[model samples]
Target: MMNDVDPQILARYAPRPGRHALLPSLTPQQQVALLCRVLHREGYNDHIAGHITLRQEDGTYLANPWELTWAEVKGSDILRLDAQGKIIEGEWNITPAINLHIDVHSARHDVSVVIHNHSEWGSVWSAVGRVPPIYDQTSALVDTDPVCYDEYRGTVEDSELGRAAADALGEHKWALLANHGVLVVANGIRQAHLRAITLEWRCRMAWRVNLLGGGVPLPAAVAQATGQRTDASGFPFLWEAMARDEIRRDPSVLE
Candidate 1:
C-alpha cells in the first residue's frame, strides 16, 4: 500500500495557483468540448437554444458563443467571460442568457458547471407545473426533489429574474424553467452534464409512467437511499466515462 502523502501536499497541487487551486481545474477548451458533447448527445441542438458553462482555473467562466449549435460547436467557440459578463477572451458574440449563467455561478460556489437546455422531455415535464417525485432509482438522480419552477413570463433579462430562478432551485441540482426549459448544475462539468441527462431521463420516465393510469412513484425512503448510494464513487462515474471517450475519439472537439 502506498504511504499516505500529506493531504496538504495533494491540496496544494490543485488547479489554481499556489493557493492549491481553490477553483476547478478545467481548461477553457475542455470546458467547451464538454459543452458541445453534452448538448449534442441530449439533442439540445433541435433549436440550438441551449447553453453550457464551466468556471475556469482562474475563476472566470467558459461558455458557448451565441448561435453556435451543439453539433457545430468547436472548442474555439468557447468564450471566456469575467464576473461582470464581459468577454475576457475568444471571438464571438455573447448570448442574452449570460445573466442567468453569471447569477447562478456567482450565487452558488458548489456549482462549477451549469447547463440550460430546452429539450422535448425536460420541457414537456416542466410545462406541467408540478414535477412528480422520484419514480425509480434513476429518478432519484435528482436527489431531494430536485425540480423547481420559474413560471417563465419572458427571458431572464435581469439579475432579479435570474436570482428568483436560482432561488427556486434552492440547493437542489436541477430546476424547471416554466414555459422555457430546464437547468442542471453541479460542481463539475461532467457531473452537471450527467445530472442534466439523468434529469431528462427521469422526466421522460415520469411522463410515460403517468400515461399508464398514473403509475405509483417510488417511496420517499427508497428515493433517499438510492440518491445517497448513486454517487458512491463521488461522481457520476458512468457519464464521465462516456464523456472521456467522446473527447478521446474526437480530439478536434478541443480545437
Candidate 2:
C-alpha cells in the first residue's frame, strides 16, 4: 500500500548508474565481499560453509574462497574461476559445492549472482520440504513459489547433482534443497543477498505461524499486486541501506 509519493521519493534516492563519481566502480570481488559481509552479519554463515558467486562478463565468476569463513572474507580473498570451476586466480581452493553455482549459472543466462547457505530457519524449512507460506508482506518479495529439490544427494560436489538442483530451480529465483538448505539466484549480488535474507525471514515467520495453527495466505491477486509494487523500488533502497551499514562497520571489505 505505498502512496504515489513514496515511489517517487524512492526513485529519487535510488542509486543511479553513475551518481557516485567519487566511489570506484563496484568490482566483482567487492560484490562477493559485500555479500559475504552482510550475510555473515545476518548470521547466514554455517562455520566455513556457504558461498556467494557473481558471474563475470566472460562467463567466469568471482566467489568467496573456501578457506575463509564468510565473516573473515575480504575483497582480496575472493577467488576467480572459470565456468567449469577451475580456479583462475586467488590463492585458496574453491569450494566443492561451487559446482552447484556453475550449473545454475550455465542454465540460467539471466542470473548473475547465486547464493547458497545453510541458514538456520531456511534449513529447518528445507528439512520439512515446505515453502514459506505467504504470511507477511516480506513473503511477497519471493514473488513465486520456491521449488524444492526433494533428493538430497550428499554434498553436491558432483556436477550432475548440481545440474539436477539447477533443474529443480528452473526459472524460480529461490530453491529449497531438501535436507540441505536454500539457494537464491538474482540478476545482481545485491538482489540475491536481499532475496536470501528475505527468504530466511519468511521461513522463520512461517515456522512461528505454524506453531500457532498457521495463518491464511493472501489472495493471489493481492499478493501479486503487492509484489509488483515492491519489486520496482523497495529492494534497491534496502540493498543500499545494507551496503552503507556494512561499509560503516568494516570499510576494509572494499579492499
> Which lDDT tens digits does candidate 2 get at residues 87-135?
9999998878899998888899989889888987889989988787878
lDDT of 1 at 72: 67
lDDT by residue for model 1 over 1-255, one digit each (tens)? 001223443465333655432223446576666657755676565566766888877888888877777766777778888977788998887777778888888888988888877877888867776676567777775456656685676776566787778777777778888887888887765456557767777887888888886777888887877766543223324544555667766767666
Highest lDDT among the candidates is held by which one? 2
Q: Estimate each model's TM-score.
A: 0.81, 0.88
Give the candidate number with the greatest TM-score: 2
lDDT of each: 0.69, 0.79
Instruction: Give candidate 1's error at residue 17 in angstroms.
Output: 32
- Please give the range of 10 consecutive residues that has the lowest summed lDDT in model 1: 1-10
* Model 1 TM: 0.81
> Root-mean-square deviation of each candidate, in angstroms?
6.7, 4.4
